[model samples]
Target chain A: MNLVGSFFGSSIGRKIIMALTGVILIGFVVGHLVGNLQIFQHPDHINGYAQFLHQLGPLLWVARIGLIAAALLHIWAATVLTLENKRARGGDYGFKHTIQATFASRAMRWTGVIVLAFLVYHLAHFTLGVVQTETFKETAPLNHYVMQNDYRVAGFTVVKAGTDVANVHSMVILGFQHKVVALFYIVAVGLLSLHLLHGFNSLFQSLGLRNAKWSWLLHKAALALCVVYFLGNLAIPGAVLAGKLRPQTAKVAATAQR
Target chain B: MTLRVWRQAGPKALGQFKDYAAKDLNSNMSFLEMLDVVNDELTLKGEVPIAFAHDCREGICGTCSLTINGKPHGPGKGIATCQTYMRSFHDGDIIVVEPFRAAAFPLIKDLVVDRTSFDKIMQAGGFITARAGSAPEANAAPVPKGVSDLAMDAAQCIGCGACVAACKNASAMLFVSAKVGHLGLLPQGQAERDRRVLAMVHTMDEEGFGNCTNQYECSAACPKTISHDFIARMNRDYLGATLRSAFQPEAASSDGGGA
Candidate 1:
């Protein structure tokens, strides 16, 4: 069999697919968290950053395509492996017990499915501006007000104004201001983190990297990183809900009232 | 002591737990010894004895298979079913005994399953092909101590299906990895190391075994207490072997030294 055919045809090879794509997906998650962290900065900073991403044009599309492909392959491999595992076991034991498997390890597929759903809703809410249509900050009165903010890039002498940029800062703030939306984001990312708890360490074993000397550190690192990642995800929505974060338009309106 | 033992007339027969209570028991007796006494009473009443598989009554020979109270090879650490003694439990305790479960090891009778699947996997490439006639000089190879120790650890696998019985996925990766790692780590094993992993793993899949999810349950249940590191080693070997095979001819020279 060819590389593709061989990988897809066997049990171990399919798992290799999962580990390989898992690496890509993990990289994307870390990069995404770092980017989204900018929401804590001045509204103009996040808005300008969104504008800069748009300016990437085809490069952004390339990344999107790669991420989408990785996601698809990861899910596909997981589905195939799950079915094979079930079938391979044949009959259920009268009394089954878990020894070393963590609750997080057992619940990987459930969390993964929900995370995928959250990803879709998130993209619609933020990327496509389709969900929560009224809250979409790309149009109307909210966009006009927020556009008054100007972004100052760190190294540049001149300010890059947000006059033409969409108010991503306000959009995120408004969306998360709704208690339900903020809570859902927290819960979704919570599950994603739980999924990563097992997945992060498991990838090494799948790729044949785990060994006696490194196993302890790998497990500890997986636990630590997953916690940090979830906290980073929790912070944005948490801050928005707490009123620490406000759109530029809201900030401007508050200043005018004074 | 009271025992809740699984009883099935045949492979296709519906099996259920049948209670056997023996007031005259010895805590010093091995788990199988207690069963032997129970069988004696059953024979007096013309009742068919509870069926189980055993050999060597040892911790080493992996033939003795049972899941006692939901644990493979009973509760004792690093021991087989035959090594599990009745002393592990209190007198009058009702021990739940059942056959090792896996699709690959089909139930043949009450507690016996056809474990020939393991045999088939091992037959694929578990042995090194070197010489048939005489023992070679030990000094000629001069194997490294660390490498030999690692090989010895992998070689300790007793072809037991306890790992499969214990895994949520029923994965045979532990066994296959041990088999692969044992030979692959040695000089004699390198000649067919790549082919060994590929063939054994392929046969394992063909026999309807699952993939390892790194749960470490297999190692936990392993009678030998084999480390899970061998699975990762085998995974590396298998990946390298697959990529190499993809690039080269199927029947590449086995010399490993050939460029």
Candidate 2:
């Protein structure tokens, strides 16, 4: 009903929105992964990251709201465009699958829905202290911080010995140590990868940039990036569940107990 | 050899593909050349030679438009019926030729239809028109090779109407997109870009051409092999136009007319 309907009312308009929003979302995912990968740097590195995000105060809230709005607009536009396309098709008369569609085109709507659902679960598991240990937050009572990758600094650095906080770090470790939560995060990353692989290449085509010279390479690059991001995120959760790596504190406990 | 062709004397006239046998046919002739032989024989026999339109026996003009044996321009890519050799067909084969038929393209006489709508759409936005009486030097503008290539791709549309005939929905999105792309790419067209895209797309809708379903069949049937990329460009242009129009709504009630 907002900018989405008018934006997607015509074929050309829908393509523009799809391309623009797809690019935005892809950029967000890349940045988000880069931030999340800080967990591998050191356990406390993520907690430091969380505290940094918390320092932005109102600006961080504003950015979060802006991101939510963008994601909502993108999903709504895609749904409306798909619905209109279906209606234009006259209620899907006849099974013409093999005739007029590729595997990626056919799976677009389904993959989109799956990715949306996975996003909700992902935010709850990692970012929100709901459904997981509260230690993932910057202001947790203990210095057990788990970084969602993006953080703002409120003047707390590793150099300041007295500023040690355990809440945020412990939250991340406790959350990932739970095999179920880690598995869900791993699957969510997989779905995100699939969504990106199709979305990135499609954006260029929709924006009318499908030139013969660069099209093939652009498509290959987008797919490769998606795969890399998916595997990178999955690796963290996979390591935890497979017992390849335990929490840093847990490894210390094992040594002391043995 | 026999030629079976569809004939409808008028728009309201019921039509059928009637067979006519050819006597003393030369195998070493063009398909149209063979048709000429049949027509000459029919005239000698005091019958109306089958009504059809063709010009420039070569394939370039695109005026030699036809749907032969359910194939546009008779089964060869980048070639027309006038250039089609009789060697392509075997003895005793009955070839069926018919006029290009669509609601937008009304048949005139026999093979010719009023393709003036195409001319009209072109006139709407297909040209790069700068200010009048101020002719700038040809080299004043510097267009990159990629833009020129894209412009050329859209320019390749010969107005053959094969896209309309091939589409089940009878969409002219491909044809209209070509016209849009041809003009939109040039620097000279930037002045009227918004108006041009809006005018062309509006006219296309009014002409009763169906919306593109992204099926890519139109590209397949096109003799020029016009890509669906132009359609994508059209979509981009249309979106830009929508945003522009929203900002600056056109003045209504500007049409002054007498009672």
Candidate lDDT values, in order: 0.86, 0.67
Task: List native contact recovery per candidate, as a fraction of 1.
Answer: 0.71, 0.12
Q: Proportion of native contacts in model 1?
A: 0.71
TM-score of chain A of each: 0.91, 0.80
Lowest summed lDDT window (length 10), candidate 2 chain B: B205-214
* lDDT (Cα, tens digit) per residue for candidate 2, span B29-58: 877788889889889999777777777877
Clash pairs (backbone) in predicted model 1: none
lDDT of 1 by residue, A17-112 (tens): 999999999999998899889988776677777777777799989999999999999999998888889988877777667877899999998999
Q: How displaced is residue B133 in candidate 1, in Å?
A: 1.1
Per-residue lDDT of candidate 2, residues A120-170 (tens digit): 876776676465443444333444333333333454342233344444444
